[model samples]
Target: MRKALAEVGQTYDVVVLGAGAGGMSATVFAALEGMRVLLVERTEYLGGTTAFSAATTWIPLTRHSRAIGADDSREKVSGFLDRAVGNRSPKVLREAFLAAGPEVVETLENKTDVHFRPRPFHPDYLYELEGATSFGRALEPTPFEAGELGADLALIRPPIPEFTILGGMMIDRDDIGHLMKMGKSLKSAVYSARLIGRYYLGKMRHGRDPRLLMGNALIGRMLLTAKKLGVDILTETETTAFVTDKNGVTGVTLRQKGIDKRITVTGGVVLASGGFSRHPKMRTEKLPHPAPEFSPSAPGHTGALHDLAFAAGAHHGTTSAQPCFWAPVSHRRRPDGSMAVFPHFVFDRSKPGIISVGRDGRRFVNESTSYHQFVSAMYATNKDGSHVPTYLIADAKALKTYGMGMIRPGGANIKPYLADGYLTEGATLDELARKLGIDANGLKDSVSRMNAYAKTGVDADFARGTTVYEKANGDPTHGPNPTLGALETAPYYAVKLWPGDIGSAMGLVGDENTRLLREDGSVIEGLYACGNDLQSIMGGVYPGPGITVGPAIVFGAIAARHAAQRAAAARRGEAGQGEAA
Candidate 1:
């Protein structure tokens, strides 16, 4: 009835899609099991979101954080995530995510070169929010050198424009700001410099290497590790169709540089090609920005592979997705597509971090919420047809002391946004109100109340002064009552900000095992998805650091592990039915 083994030398245990952390993580474990693994990524680079725009990988509310003096648990973590989607996250997936998170992080640490250190100072978005712990759950990847990547390193995108990796070095979070600080102990200063210098030397030798010492560092390093472990990486390729037989998946039709090719395999297909963030057509019809210009996410997050999977008939949960998280560039864009930071002198003086307001010039929600929520709020508002331009309001002291109102002008120098009306400024509460084109009387009163709270360090309407860190990050020396001073300080600054998103958080649904599924609730044999490409386990909400990459690694590994098991069975005369929970 069936053809015997063809021995075409083309089949293997697993084929991981999207060489980014999500896909790579799955491949790593699968390959570790001694199975032949083939990995495919549409982008020239690997590490998906982690490579292009990952700030941190979140693994909060874990047992480690609690054992280390911070208090938290799965119940609290589940509370936040479930509240976001009203329990839409399937119980199996939720339990699997919680159960496997720590194990996944632990595996990366002991098995491969991926290193993670706890960031204790990084607090939860809402410090007092239930189950919110100050540390433990936030593990930042150590820096790495790009030289280890050898030839493949050049293909991956650097974390951002300024942040580059070279050789095998990896940079961690703790060392970032310390690199610039001046008052460290003599020994500490000398040690930090030597460490940084060593990394620089490595990068120098491996020109254009990634800084594998930090968040992006580990992501890049591990990808190279997976490749070294016999993972076949076919770049610039697309899985156009899922070749199937009576039992399940049989192979895939792939395209490269517009040429069609087919690869028949007995193992499964893991779809980690990422979300629809960069799709020009999807951007126009969905996303808030409505612009086809560059999104920081790596290219090929077009949801094309997703469409193909759906056509093949798979059961999935929610398909509507967006980069549930990300931030707007505070300044403006550089020619190389990076953001320019407004002088710190400005932020230190005044600027309550601008608010991306709707048509009304009022506080919508906590602007300080994680960047993910900011974009989500923006998306939600836009979906309802609300035209909102962000407004950044700051006092004149905010102006003279800091480059308070400035964004990248794509010009030679950073220009004050206020000068070009990209930002609006004025003196006096009423005048400032008039400049913003809002009800001058309403704005004046708003200023009056905001000032009163600033005086007493207590915001009555919005409790802006509640968080000590918020104020600490603000002007601590702003005189008699810091935070208040009546904004009465001559000249005010207000700039408009758009809702910038990191990437969408919806795509092919997967189970706790991270098995890729169809819209109708059937698992597409061998298919798996994670990161922004899978429906967010957090329901498009960011609960903590590494929120994007953390799950990616967890589920990616999960997907690969099962694929390996299935592959081994097919090699034998046994019926290759995958084991399930």
Candidate 2:
């Protein structure tokens, strides 16, 4: 139950910081093991960035995959990870993750309200790598009814405003196709009508749509489970410092409502505090030079607790290839004056009739590559920061068919976008290039070359559509090459793209059991880390969808289990001493 700082109990078996996917998982699983748990969040809401995500969890060799007859095994997944990640991360950590992933799924399903279903054909981003499969690893949360949460529904963090439709209705990936084709197909029309009808009815009654999808559903299910297990949840509570003894961390000092309070823990404290993406000092120190100005991460990831962790002898991971995960995002100002940052993930770039270019107005990278790779290419080619703000240009047909940035598919009224200068439009490619302050002749030559590549069904410059992952994100109905088409339609449009990180990758170094480790390699007893708080298991490599959340859940559970076992062992030691006396 959520309580004020003064009302909460002074002691808990385990205290979890940050109520994101990893922290919530640790709370629920710890409670299942008969521990009294306390969950604290710095923000007013429970879900962190997880609430705004697609919630595609990548865990291999689960019952969900087996039920779907997905031809996969430990050997295949290991091989794929071996090639994709190499030695960027420790092999022991990877082995532990693979071994415990399916168990975590099974435990959560059998003992709690948390549930998931496999995506039949979600391919790994590096599908061309050894032993990569086109299906079965990615699992999406089952849709949940917010009504089930009753009065506590308001505590769940809302999805990103740009991601929702009709003010507050959340749409799933499957719902997109139906809504897009509603005008053309009778079946799709019916589906769209019912979905919209339900949304309106629920909104009228509850002041917000009660049906939750994607990350909302995932967090809702976990939140419901945490409540049922009787975990003490406190929001708007900030951790000030770690309370430690000669044995290690024993509790935490928190500031709530401008008053400080100390909460004792017998098991351990798990750090899943969403990492240092928002930390002013850490971002400049750890992130690449010329750091990104915009990020889609949650507001609570200030890395305040990281200082305390470091003071207690914990160190950051050393082997990560990058400090943060990358995405090409577009920004626009809303009517309320808040900036609307949209990450162009798996949507416009991979579709046909679109291309990205540097200031020279020539293609800098393959348009059909993954979002991470696309942004990496931008930075790789941007020696003088010219490509920091590149242009994503699409003709009228492509813009209407696939949507650019925050604009919806088939969006007709773009007056506001043009008025705010979020969008640039011109009658011809040369004109578009001129408006964008790029070399007009270079753009014309580039378009002429692309038109030739389209006719030949090949991207000679960068090989756009050769990968299965790229094709899967493209329009299957398109002929010859799913990701290739000429940008010949008049009234071309463009949006400025910038490097934006979704989350931090380099974090506190920990062992396989989620226990924090010092620089000398000794474990810091009674303290653990997971989620973005823990150094990413993939070593900053974008291997597949849901890699972050998948390990978050697995290691969260591992931390809770290890803490419980330690408490049990301590109890056994005391009992034996009494018997000997």
Candidate 3:
């Protein structure tokens, strides 16, 4: 299966593998510094897992945050991280992230087309913790027009199909709010009309409205800048082996659309190949049971880069307390007989009159908690190791107001979901318990307790709506406790839940410069890793929105800058020798 090349395919100052947020950022930053860069991606499309994400970046103390009057002081953020990560936190890595993160955002925004808007009131996930602010830290990409990519439009991965409406009209956070209130208010009706009108016009001219938003928009902006700077992008190419001699990572051997090719590089290699979310072996070894079969990430997350790096003598990090970042996901079989998974990030769990229960029909954790905390509680409570599914229970009124999983609000076509076994319905508590094979008595008691809490506006058992984080997810317009309302309506429903990981927290141990380290604490000559491949600075704790993407952008830039600097120094050395000759 192996073939040796008669001659190397090409040479470049830097060769960046993978085209997700990390790799794209690295490519742009490296190219910005005048480095001849070759960016390769395994899939035909760029963006990778990040394209399917919400595209929020949690960059604290950013200029936008400061402008918006955020109190993102160094002491404050550090206190929050200390509580979240504790002893596992790497001080230097955290310091580097805090120092370089804002600059990276500034560079992309100022020098490139990559633009971001501040989420001034976005609360940190653990708002209950000390030093957590009620607002100002997270930044999101502004919507981008896909037409700017031209023929390369097809090369970008689209967002999850569930997030779109009307066969490819991608909606953002603001659009969702407007669409939810459409026809009920005049303002919402006008906003919805304007959004749909533009989508139709875009579709009429282009096969698909290339109006990219969220993660897709973020990647698109980076790709546009890379193209303008003449960065060479090789899609459908995978790095199979790293070529080395006296120095580490001299180049890489790649299989490009099936043909074997070897490319030499003088600068260095940057590995930002997303994460190993889809790798079965890695999942079994690292992640807990009920490992997700339906990830929103790209299918090429096979952990190939991890294997390659490990073989090259890279050591992994010790932040295994929380190995993977998790979210609860609901699944349904599409018309094509494929499973469509939709992550319940902010949609159903935190709404009033909803509670997540285990097989025994007992509420396990605070339903309004962060996705990471919710799933962690699920793992901790599944004591017997049985493969029973966790269920999100809601009544007809709650279902209509806030749809469960793939089911949209306003009671949209539940007949098909029930027929497909994706949703379970019960006219009463006992019937629902029997249908789900849960304890009927336990289910009745749970309902009674919920009704009591709803009436009294207090959840003594789990304190669901007590924190700012929980209230943020709740319907603020609702009564006493926005997250706690009586589930007393008839025809109750439930959707099975599974633990889904966005990316791995445990990764290769690397330094602030993004250089991979050996177990003995020495750096691997020229090998570098960033993104989800590098150990999370938060030490596996999901502190807030965009924590994952923020570090990915920062470390990717750090790796690129380091490689470019080395290449420049080497070039100058060669030039001096030639002049002496």
Q: Judged by TM-score, which candidate is best?
A: 2
TM-score of each: 0.81, 0.98, 0.96
lDDT of 3 by residue, 18-121 (tens): 88888988999999999988888888788888899877888888889888898779889977888888867588898898889888989998999999998757
Off by over 4 Å in 1: 1-9, 60-67, 83-85, 126-129, 162-176, 183-203, 284-294, 319-323, 329-333, 336-360, 379-387, 396-445, 465-491, 574-581
Task: Give the clash total for candidate 3.
Answer: 2
Report the lDDT of model 3 for residue 370.
Answer: 91
Question: Candidate 2's residue-wise lDDT over 1-581, tens digit each?
Answer: 89899988888878999988899889888998888899999999988989889888999999999999999999999988988888888888999999999999999999988899997789899988988888899999999987878878888898999999999899987898899889999999999999999999988877787898888888899999988888898999999999988758989998899988999878899999899889999889888767999988688889998888998889898788888888999999888999889999988997888888889988989888888888888888997777989999889999999899998888689989999899999999888988999988878777888888888878999988998998988899996788888899999999999999988789999999999998989988889999999999899899999998999999999999998887667668879999999
Model 1 lDDT at residue 507: 59
Residue pairs with clashing backbones, model 2: none
What residue runs in model 3 are displaced by over 4 Å at the alpha carbon? 1-9, 385-388
Give the CA lDDT, 0 to 100, for residue 304 in model 1: 81
Clashing residue pairs for model 3: 120-136, 146-210
Indicate which candidate wins on lDDT. 2
lDDT of each: 0.60, 0.89, 0.84
- Write the number of the candidate with greater lDDT, choosing between 1 and 2: 2
